[model samples]
Target chain A: MIARLVGDAAGVMSGGVLIGPGDDAAVWQPPPHRAVVVTQDALVEGEDFRREWITPHQLGRRCLAVALSDLAAMGASAAWCTATLCAPAETVLDDVLALALGLREEAEATGCRLVGGDLSGIRGPLVVDVCAGGSVEPERALRRGAGRVGDVLAVTGTLGGAAAGLRALFGRRPPAAAPAQVDAWVETWRRPRARLIEGRRLAALGVRCAGDLSDGLLVDAERTAAASGCRAELRLEQVPLAPGLRTAFPDAWGELALGGGEDFELLLAAPRPLLERIALDWPPELAPITPVGVLREGSGVSLYADGAPLPLPRVLSRHFA
Target chain B: MIARLVGDAAGVMSGGVLIGPGDDAAVWQPPPHRAVVVTQDALVEGEDFRREWITPHQLGRRCLAVALSDLAAMGASAAWCTATLCAPAETVLDDVLALALGLREEAEATGCRLVGGDLSGIRGPLVVDVCAGGSVEPERALRRGAGRVGDVLAVTGTLGGAAAGLRALFGRRPPAAAPAQVDAWVETWRRPRARLIEGRRLAALGVRCAGDLSDGLLVDAERTAAASGCRAELRLEQVPLAPGLRTAFPDAWGELALGGGEDFELLLAAPRPLLERIALDWPPELAPITPVGVLREGSGVSLYADGAPLPLPRVLSRHFA
Candidate 1:
């Protein structure tokens, strides 16, 4: 079944892929002298998505994007990907092919070849797992542990929209007047864009510490801090919320923005000097970079509002604090 | 959860692994100037194995072995692997950890690094998917399409043991007198070994066409034939039967040996001269090779018994022919 998917994966030619699916494995050549940054991520049916909320095609694109987000954080070029799909026996072949097509489209969008994968029957919820990798110059790849004590934290694009979209997807019918904004939020949740360009730009600008906002700000912030041996002091007032997120869920926007997760945006930390230079040369069309926090000589993450430490939220879940 | 597994994956370090699990992704430096062979394979709970039948540790080992088999077929030296697990929320942490330990053990045994992965909640049975890769010499890796019409087909190791083991596990209680052999067969099914060494030997010996017999001899032979644009002709009488398989089930041995998948053996097509040379130099420590078939100027597969064309098995499954 996996070998057959190679026929459907008619993707634009990428430089490194020497063999695409249908054999014992796919073979590729990484650029000479470049280190490979690899990551694997998965989305389960019930836990990650509801069938009624997202089409198979969208789910396909979303899965690839989610995995690619890690490569984005590493500031690696999109090169190749392999996906494993475990679906029920009753699943229609067309659905499987549609999912493959979704993967192909995403690969085309990112220039990552959908090289090879495995397919198997499952007795439960659908599972799509993708392993993505790309090349980065040795010793220059961004890492979470590379942050410094005085590094300022900045993020690509806004946050909380995907989480808000998830809430709206469940039971929170948006205010009728704000239906359009809610739809856009839902779209953001459905189709995530990996910040590949911004990540490269940051790396080129000499930003070495970075990670993706897959689990939203609070968790990823705490993680980056723990890895970098410092504290993430997030200034809530300075954090940029997704457009209309504050207006749609005025009471819960803070928690949603901090904890809602599913935002494929990147959070980067660099010396303020580099951050200033990056800001000065940042392209106007790219997702606007906004200062959100700083790495201090502490541990974990501390939330502050108006320069005063705000108590951590009771829980950073879909329910919002 | 994936980040936590990195703590459990204390593995024997192989060269080129710059990073292991944890962080957003794992970083690795492939052998400089070597092409990479990447493959992904998955084992879904219930469909692939019932928890009652195999221990979590064995399942973990099996999953990694299954994915590694593809790399083995490519004659790529195993380098690194990433696993994604989707387990029910009710799953015990110890089981998950045990599974990770299993993966680590297999990686240690094979000299592959269990570098990184992703963990997620699933509403259904557990699913473990692994993406494994290794470096191969550019333009030198074995491929299914490299066979010629007149090449004789040879397989490493005996066939049908794992499939027969599957039947034995399913209440086909082997003849009580053969309990010891039956037990060994069962072990073969529970713990698969990728023929990595033999594959590397084949490549070193200049064998260009080979693939793992994961879906049994019939399916895999057909696939290799199709990929090479030729027909496969097998002499059933010369084909190897797993030790004790023929005696245990004389009537079904042919079908089980032909169609029962998961053998994880390698089938190769090479010129007669190369086969003779390989046989002379084949190591006694490795699984014995047996010539069972030949590639011909046609499509599909033809089975012969005592020099007479034999009808293909009615069905190649646990039920036998």
Candidate 2:
């Protein structure tokens, strides 16, 4: 059944995939003069998603997107990916087929090939682990350690939508929002897109420091600061919140914007002049880039609202305690 | 705890690893003029192993070896690997650290590097998935479709040891082996080694078709035959049995040797003269190569015992039904 599903979803191979499925391993001839960037991420059924909240197709695409976000964070172009799915024997074959199809679609959309994968029967929750590899010019690749003092911190797209969506999915008190707004939030949560174009442009524009907003702004900002030996200071008022987020949760909008995870947006750091130039030349098709913070000669992260000091909210991390 | 464990296990990096842990993704510079071979394998708690059957250290090493076997089958040198471990929150941090240590040890021993990984909290069983990447000459890669009619089939190292070891661990009817022999069998099962040296030697010797004996001889041979559009004729009497295996299970040795899985040995196919030439130049330090079969113009696999046709045993797959 797994073989049939893989065959049905194989589709037309792209990139430089020389050996695809049904081999001991997939072989690919990577482009020359490029470094390979690799990352692995996994989503367990209960921990990462609820079956009722996501279809198998959405889950499949979401898994690849989550892993690809790391490559985006590194400013690497998508190349290929391999996935491992562990499901219960009782799982419907159609679900598996739909999941593989979704994966194939996402791979094709991102210019990557679903070269190979493994499937197995499990006695517990479904587990999807994806390992993505991409190529990047080594000298121009983005790094967390490249932030400098007085550098401006910018983010692509709006934040807090996915967090709002999660609340809509699991919060006991239903958000007081219009149905259309709620649906938009849910859509953001279900299918967060990796900012691939924005990431590549950053690298092309000579920006060196950036990371994905998978763990929200506050946590990721702090991480970037620590890696670069500096501090992150955010102007809360400048943060671009998702549409209707402030209206949906007047009191909690700040929390969601600062602590909500899975935004899948790129957080970049560069000199103010360079950032201004990038904004002037940014493509209209890509998400809008907004300056939200700056790096300073200190440690940790700080927040300010309308130039007034604001206390930091309790941050919830995705993995770290 | 995961961060600290990774930090402690992050030894001096090698194998073109430019960026190791504590990053969005690892960056590696691959050797020029080579193709990248990639494979992913996972070991789940209930499906692939049990807590009572193996130590954390052994499990760690075993997981990496399993993935590396795929690269070996393609005659790719070990390069680097990333792993994801999903465990319940109640899991002991010490065990996780020990497992990482074991992985690091194996990586260093095999001239590979542990570049990056993910650690997650699970609600159910432990899950460890590993993705390994290596460089191989595209023109010289060992492939399943490269076998030809009249090619002599050879395998490195002896078979059935791991199977016998598994039997000693879980068989309903215990074999009549001595305590020392049983201990050896258990050790063999617990610490299977990937035939990396033998695989590289085969590729260097211009051998074309090869695969790892991950699913025992019968199943893998059948797969090779189907891939190459030829029949695999096995001389059952010529197969090299693990020491004391036949003595321990005289009635079941054939089945175990031909049908049992998880033996990390290499199976190769080449013409008679080429096989003899490779044998003449085989390194003494590597595992011994033994001829046990031949490829013919037909389909499926056939077995002969002492010059007489023998019935194939019921092959039990590790995962597929």
Candidate 3:
């Protein structure tokens, strides 16, 4: 399979890709203002999703959304995208069109249009790979390398809902039903809101350090710290969790918040003054920007439960990793 | 496997994607640009390639080259690129770095960059998916829809060398031992070049109907005809075949030329006046553009073999559906 083939060739190619994978788009800065970004992610059936958990429409929407989220992380807007589809010949044309429609709708929401792509027949399972593009200004672009000492780290939304939703769907213990009110946690996993708006807002605020929290807060925070050569200390109490998550799985909600993946929210940082201004403009519901911690002059990332330093988990999560 | 999972969900969806997964790239005309061109192709080990046929570096270069061919057909410049790699966990680190270096070299050759990409470990086979981006002037972008009746068909490069190289490699007959020259044919298959210069030059000559001939000329010509609601009358004698192809397999050369794939050349059409100008500007060595046929105001594609209409093949050749 193509996915397996990709795994065979994927190794850490240091200093080869200026921007490695894991952004809304991957950019290569050519001469002049001709900068462009390309992004791709593959969604595999029974692995990335299940029909019982998502319809074709929602499935298509999620596939494009995740790829587009990479662009948002780079502080770039998605301009275009492509998809490679492999499915059985017996699949209905309407279902395929619905997938197309779903992709189109999500792409348009991000101000993109479906330009072109490929479709093929396969004997087993289905896979969709989406690639998106965007342009970046030379002077203003943000990257994982730009975090500074004492910069205030913040996130655009709360976490743990998507994992909770999965738990709810899988009927882990009590087989809970989805709540009727605006459940941000489940929504984050089902239909992640790419932080383009918040990215632009942060960009306007001259915040140079940023990344998306797709691989959970702790792991991504560790990455930011390692990439920026600074130590990130997060206030465990300040780290927001989904409203109902703590009540539902009281023991593991915190672990899910710290270690669960696929939240797709923005993790950005700025100096103290800019952080204060951002907190004022941010809406608590949509994106409650909060100061979780500071970037210290050191290496590696750490967590603080109250005033005591906590050990970071060593086991990598299966999904994002 | 991930491929099975992707195939099952068919595709992912979120709100706002306008057109996803069927075109060149997801075209989000966000803000400044009204039209954007994107393209992608995946190369799999034990399928599209073998280490004996290509180096990891050449594999990386070829992935970008194949995807860029689509951009070239659209008369666009190569701007950005991303790669998704799946390989073995124990693969040597240098092989991975060399692949990135090769991608970087090619990106620089075509004024592009290696932006972002993903890496993962899988059981077997290696797949490299290259996604590329380019920009088109909204007013002047070419498409498969613009092939007009009376338009003369043309091609940009020599054909059949890549397939010939495959035969030479596998020893279907006595192998060609002239290592230096035979290597060129092998390179045609292993490291095909995108005709970006030729595309821009043709576009400058007012040629708007075009497509890359990734799957033999016969198949792509049919695509142009079908999309444009016109019929293509290909002059078999006028088709350009590489020198050694005819000599090595004289009786079967025509079939190989007609059905063989992975030439990465352009198959386009324009008015007679425009054709003359395009021919004048196109490099004779790299492309040697030639007029091969004309579009009729009808449907379906056809071939004229020895001054008689012949039954056309329905399916394209290997690796492409």
Highest TM-score, which number?
A: 2
Report the C-alpha lDDT of model 3 over B1-321, residue by residue, as the tens digit: 222211221244222122233211222222244244567777766556666878988887888898888778877766666666666556777787777778868887997655556655544455577777765554455667688899999887778778767666665542433565566677788888998888877776688888888778788788788767899999888888876777667666777677767778888878888788666656665567877788998887789977998776443365632
TM-score for candidate 3, residues paired by index: 0.80
Q: For residues B1-321, could you state the per-residue lDDT of candidate 2 as single tens digits?
A: 445645543456678888888778888888899989999999998888888889999999999999999999999988999999998889898899888888877887888888888888888899999999998999888998899999998888888888887777775334578878877877887887888878888998899999998889998898898889999999999999988888888888998888777878888899999999888878888889999999999999999998899989887565432
Worst 10 residues of 2 chain A by lDDT: A1-10
What lDDT does model 3 reach? 0.67
Identify the superior model by TM-score, candidate 1 or candidate 3. 1
Return the candidate ranking by DockQ, descending.
2, 1, 3
Per-candidate TM vs. native?
A: 0.97, 0.97, 0.80
lDDT of 1 by residue, A105-202 (tens): 99889988888888878878888999998888867788888999999998999998898788888878667428888888899999999999898888
Please state the CAPRI-style docking class of candidate 2: medium
Measured by DockQ, the strongest candidate is 2
Report model 1's chain A TM-score. Answer: 0.95
Report the CAPRI category for model 3.
Answer: incorrect
Candidate order by TM-score, highest to lowest?
2, 1, 3
What is the Å distance of residue B198 in model 1 from its true position? Answer: 0.7
Best by lDDT, which number? 2
